[model samples]
Target: MSLKSIFAIPFAKLATKKVYKWANKPFQTQEKVFQKLIADAKQTAFGKDHDFENIKTYEDFKKRVKVSDYEGLKPYVDRIVLGEQDVLWPGKPLYFAKTSGTTSGAKYIPITKESMPTHIKAARNALLFYILEKKDASFVDGKMIFLQGNPVLEDKNGIQLGRLSGIVAHFVPNYLLKNRLPSWETNCIEDWDTKVNAIVDETIDENMTVISGIPSWVQMYFEKLIAKTGKPIAEIFPNFNFFVYGGVNFEPYKNKFESLIGKKIDYVELYPASEGFIAYQDSQTAPGMLLQLNSGIFYEFIPATEFYDENPTRISIKEVRLGVNYVIILNTNAGLWGYNIGDTVEFTSLQPYRIKVTGRIKHFISAFGEHVIGKEVEKALKDSIKDTAINISEFTVAPQVNPESGLPYHEWFIEFENEPENLDDFTQKVDDSMQAQNIYYQDLIAGKVLRTLVIRKVKKGGFHEYMKSIGKFGGQNKIPQLSDNRKIADVLQNFLIE
Candidate 1:
């Protein structure tokens, strides 16, 4: 065995044991963690303002701190960007993670020194779990190429501002550093096209075993690599075995990835957002990602249907029931208390707290009371096309509340690499599939409250063009699959060819 292989096996085994210990502790010591986190922040400006000292129990903490969104904490976050200390966290933020905003402009999320390890540790444990599950360390000896954002951070006000992936790249463990691909200089290039080309050149002939990135962007890189080398990815990197993906559902792109790589490889999915590393797929045999309970973040779940209610029920990890969609609220070491990160998830398992990301809080279609989620829409589309030859590139769904002439219906704009011969038949299949999965949708249809779904084929490259027009074409940018209204749909109309 190679020296690197020998070194990685023992390290992987040790990390697996440590992660298991830490993960299980939250179940038994959740209240202790709640007390400790509050106690640690009691002296901070936010803590003092919120009367944190008197809080003693989980109930007290919930009563004192209101569930909040970005707008609720904008003032504190704005002050931190100006290099203010102790406004939120104990000290000035080490950096800021810029993310897509909702009603407001770009959101600048603070990342503190104390909370940085939470992101790092969860990521490390995810890989370690994969290692333990496979009982293989040979891949660790080979290089891992993570498609990350530009490491060249921009100064905003006084704090450093950059993508979360870029910030995470800066803290990859020392031992793994030796096996990481793509030179640091290349990683700093802001232009994604140029950076990806540089990565292809640097790692094309290297002993690469693992590749990690958002699925779409990684697919773009794979296409470029194949174009440049004139060989399948399997031939270019024979050791490449693990495909680490997050940010979007991998099902839509799974077949394409396998076709490019020339084989089906072990896959790991991560449930990481700019807010925190929330969960990871721990077992190859299991279906859902195990929620990270002890990773410096306290989580609460409110049923998605009741999210906008004045006093929605907040569920603890132990209280979560399987098959219910919940909007996650986080209290993180980064000093975000009761913050709603806007993503929605459904618990798949209660024993180990496993979950599947269902949709974003804002990305749901409820016109005519159908209440279709992004997960449902995406799944329906995938299911409808499974037996057909259609290959989808990207898609979005919007509610057509007031059509020029017909009953209100769901409108889909899809960009296809290969389309079904009969568009009406394709739309029928998708509509039938959606009805099968969502009872509300089926009821609405049967009651004559809604008509069949409408399909509009977007021009080739329309989705990417729209993303570029908004200056967010690459690196963690994904089109919202479902919207409550036609705001995104209206914008997408500009990109659709007649």
Candidate 2:
């Protein structure tokens, strides 16, 4: 065994123990921990302004601090962006992670010193848990090639701003630094296509064992690697055994990614965002990611259906039930109190606190009261094309309300890496799978309230072209799987060849 592998074993064991303690804490002292978090921040300007001094209990904290989206909290955030201290959290943020907005310009999220460890430490524990579970440190013994955004941060006023991956890239440890592929200089390239080519050239001969990125961008990297080497990924990186991915569900791209790699490798799903590192898949045997309860962030769940309610019921960890779709509400150490991050999740397990990311709150098609989310669309597409030779590169679903003719329908725009032999049959299977999964959709069809889903097989690179047109071509910008309205659909039509 390598010297690195020997050290990794002991460290992995310690991380596992720490993660287990944190994962189980919510079952016992979640309320007390939450109260303490609120109490700790009570001296801040926001806490004072919101009357956090009176919040002695969890309910008081909830009642006092109104749940806010980015727009609602923008005024206070503006103060921080302009270099104000003690405005929201206890102190000024270390940096701001800028996330692309759906309808607006850009969202500047804070990454404070207090909250950085919550992200960085959880990321460390995730890998450690993976190492522990695999019973092998060779994965760590080799290099990792992460397809990330520019690590070179931009100065917005006096505060630093960049993509979350870029921010994290700046902090990759010294030991891993030797094993990490594609130097920071290469990662600093803003253009994804240009950066990916540079990454491929740099890491083509490296002893890579791990790959991490948003699935689509990683897929692009893999494709470029294969094109360059004229060999499957396994031939290039024999030690490559593990994959870590997040930002979007990997189910739709699984077959295509596996096909490119030419081997079945273990993968762990992460729930990291500009907001925080929420969770990670801890066990190879388990399906869902274990929610990090002891992370400096406190979490609450409101049922997705009642999310827009004037006083929606917010459930604590102990109060959350299995199988219910809940929109997440976070009260973090970073000063985001009762903030809605706009993602939805469903609990798969309560014992160790595991969850499956259902979808985004905004990225869903509910134009016809059939609230079909990204998760559903992805699952439906997977089921639809499972038996076929179809290899989907990317896809998105949008409602066709007030169509030129006939009943309104869901329109699927797909970019296939490998096209199905029978397109009609493939679309039929998709419609069948969606009907089976979503009752409202099934009912709408049965009642003739909507026509069958329309399938538009776009030319290869259609999704990419559309993203580029919208100035969202690179760096963790994924095609929305489902849009509530026809905004994306109408725009996408301009990119379609047929």
Candidate 3:
């Protein structure tokens, strides 16, 4: 490791001490953690009943409040974004973290003032972990490149300044401001097309020590780095010490990245969203660094199986189960109440709420960790697909294990507007994409988990028809890009090769 990585480790160790202590010792109950907000929400804010009517026990809060997505909290978010009274979190929110989700589309989530401490804690968690792992906090203390999203300038209302990533950046202490990659303003852009290319050009020769972003965006940057420089990525940013990515799963793309960079730089996976920084990469081998819930947010877990039920069970930090997958629902100090953030998690252990992200409950496959879930497969395909005409409009995956072979096979059905004339080559590319991206799938293919491989090309408009049939075209619910089985998968299954 370099000087920065080694020098900054003690600080990282101190960070571990703080965050681990915080995680291992979360509150006894949700109410105790969120008493202030529950008290505040009782007052009608913007003429809405957002407060706990009589929520006392953790059970009472779980029963009184249902898990919410963006739609469920639209009323609260709409009000808070308009700068109304504090509805969800206490005190005035500094800014909205305008982030994009596959389900909600684009949401400007409010980051309340009280929640700033939580964000700071999570940031410290990531920084601390990087330092501890590298044995060098000064490296991170030096310049770091957070290849993040910029705010959207919306004229819908007069002077609506929206930056999903910027809101988080807005909270960075002035002392750490200079440490940010691409001097806040210098790196941001109105046109993503030009902005991304420029990001590649500027850092091609920089002494970049740390690089962080969502995995999809980061992998794309890697591809761009390779295409433009025509040199291996290590040559592009030789001084780069670590890759810290969050907001999306990186496991599926691990192989592709390893293939590109030649050797693995230290990698950190963070779990931050519009709401707040959820988890960080402290132990390189652990599932995930359990978030410091003292971020002033109340975290609730709904068993993955219970996610869609009228009223499935909800468990608080006090009652979380280890080894079981759960849908993470958050009641952030950021004006979100009983929000189901749509992430599935498994506890590394229950003692301190250490968790590993299993998969989105809505998207995980139980049969074989095929986990062909939406996010995993999406990341896998996004990292794999190098063709433009074959850009997936919609797709879903199902494991059709051959009974005779006693092995599962990944059968994918995809909708594409542009069909390559050489269908065989196109299909091979998809298979290659999967093999190169998912080590498990690659191993399965080598083994029998995939006794065979198949890719089915569905009719151009068929997937849309299936989505329409399900009354889901766009918005909070679109056809999941990957799944165990659905109309899209069934329809496209016939196209797979035996």
Cα-based TM-score, every candidate: 0.95, 0.97, 0.72
Predicted candidate 1, C-alpha RMSD: 1.9
Instruction: Report the lDDT tens digits of candidate 3 across residue range 1-498.
Output: 445446456656776787666565677444556786576666546214533667666666665677778888787767666666555555456666555555667776776567767766677667676656655554644566676556334532322446556546666666566666665454567454456677777776666767777654565577678988787777776767678776545554555566677677778777767676777666766666665566767888877766778878777777776767778888766667778777787778555666666556656543565444454566555645553434444556776644445556676676554555776666666677666755766777776556545567777556546655554432113344455555456654444333
Per-residue alpha-carbon lDDT of candidate 1 for residues 278-323, written as tens digits (9 for 90 to 100): 9999988888898887777888889999999999998777788899
**Which sequence of candidate numbers ranks them by lDDT, best first?**
2, 1, 3
How would you encode candidate 2's per-residue C-alpha lDDT over 1-498 as one tens digit per residue?
A: 788888997899987887677567775556665877778788888889889888877777777888888888888899998888888887788899988765556999998898888788878788888888877888777888878788888997778898888899888888888888788789888888899889998899888999998888888889889988899999999998879998888888988988898999999899997888889989989889989777777899999999988888987887999999999998887878888999999999988889999999888888879999878888888897676667889888888889899999999988888887888888888899989999999999999999989888778777778888988888688887888877778888877766
Model 3, position 455: C-alpha lDDT score: 65
Give candidate 2 regions above 4 Å deviation. 102-104
* Lowest lDDT 10-residue stretch of candidate 1: 22-31
User: Which candidate comes out best when scored by TM-score?
Assistant: 2
Candidate lDDT scores, in order, read 0.85, 0.85, 0.63
Runs with alpha carbons beyond 4 Å of true place in candidate 1: 156-158, 387-389
- For lDDT, the strongest prediction is 2
Per-model RMSD to reference: 1.9, 1.4, 8.2
TM-score of 3: 0.72
TM-score of candidate 2 on Cα atoms, chains taken together:
0.97
lDDT of 3: 0.63
